[model samples]
Target: MAAWGQRLAGVRGVLLDISGVLFDGAEGSGVPIAGSVEAVARLKRSRLKVRFCTNESQKSLGDLVELLQQLGFDISEGEVTAPAPATCLILKERGLRPYLLISDGIRSEFDQIDTSNPNCVVIADAGESFSYQNMNKAFQVLMELENPVLISLGKGRYYKETSGLMLDVGAYVKALEYACGIEAEVVGKPSPEYFKSALQEMGLEAHQAQ
Candidate 1:
């Protein structure tokens, strides 16, 4: 297997994370870090495949793409990837249909949302729509279902700058877990499958991007 830094550093296709790598998160504002927009544009001009990946539970691939473009970074829908899409796959495999409590963007990935089912696959993206109503519903579903899957797109205060780390999916996920008394099944980053999918899309083998 190839180490990620080694192989990726030399590849034509480079997958960049939006919040930290491209933009500082503490800026809260949607725009990317100052030079990031231009830096990404320059990479594109070099004929490299650049995919901006984010754990943002709020925006969808299409939405992020548009935002990036407006912020001066050139990108497309197919060039972006989010954990919600992967969460959809995990839910399907479990044969569990969730009364999904998510943003319109997250909900858009699913074919249907069964409101009655107590079982839920919580997908937290820290998006703008994340609210009390949504959290309450998710808690209720977790309380009802003995074991609900809480697939975190990624954990941490992804956005950062000069100040310090901020609250992120981990905080929300932990709060829900404590309130519901049911542990969640997280499926995201450091999850080999997620990395595998990213690598595969870039036309590289698993070890190739180790």
Candidate 2:
């Protein structure tokens, strides 16, 4: 077989990571990585299909698209793929009400959904909302459900912050899994299906795209 570089020489499409690639989350809102804007512009000019894949479920799709635009990247909402849509789909299909443990800034993403009589606990980067009482409440909700399902947007262990590397939602999700004796259904990066979905959106198969 040819070398990896040779194999990727004919790549027609790209699925790019958001955090730590195009931008860094150290500043909370995110600061563009050096030369990322110009690089993305070059990619756009190349007429190659591109999609921005992010595990950040903290913001709605629209919000993320707007942020990218503000940062000087020529991107559209259609080119963005995040876990929120998948999470919403799973909740609807399973008929499970969400006991959302997400950040206040992004809570509006699920505002339209029915959260009444929650039977499922959905966890994300809750920031200050990851309180002891709230965690206990989520634990209690899981215990009450006959068949509880824990949905984790992403299993990122830690993330870069302005201060330093801080624990991410995955750490909390793991704790809950250990306590509840159940695994969380992860719906973001590192999940092969998620990557495949992004590739599908770009109209390219995994092997055809990077």
- Per-candidate Cα lDDT values, in order, are 0.65, 0.86
RMSD of each: 4.3, 1.9
Task: Supply the TM-score for candidate 1.
Answer: 0.76
Q: Each prediction's TM-score against the native? A: 0.76, 0.93
| Alpha-carbon lDDT of model 1 | 0.65
- The CA root-mean-square deviation of candidate 1, after full C-alpha superposition on the true structure, stands at 4.3
Candidate 2 lDDT score at position 104: 75
Candidate 1 C-alpha error for residue 184, in Å:
3.1
Q: Model 2, range 1-210, lDDT digits (tens) per residue? A: 579779878798988888778877654477889999999999888867888998887777788778788888898988888898878888888888999988876787787678999989999878788999999999999988888799999999988865678788899999899998899999998899899889988889887787
Q: Tell me the deviation in Å of residue 186 in model 2.
A: 0.3
Cα lDDT of model 1 by residue, 1-210, tens digit: 467556567556766777666755434346477788778878878767666556766666666666677777777878766777777777777777776656675566666534355466565654555689878877776666655555566665444445765666767777776886656565556566777677777886644432
Off by over 4 Å in 2: 1-5, 26-28
Reference-based lDDT, residue 47, model 2: 61
Clashing pairs in 2: none
Task: Work out how many backbone clashes candidate 2 has.
Answer: 0
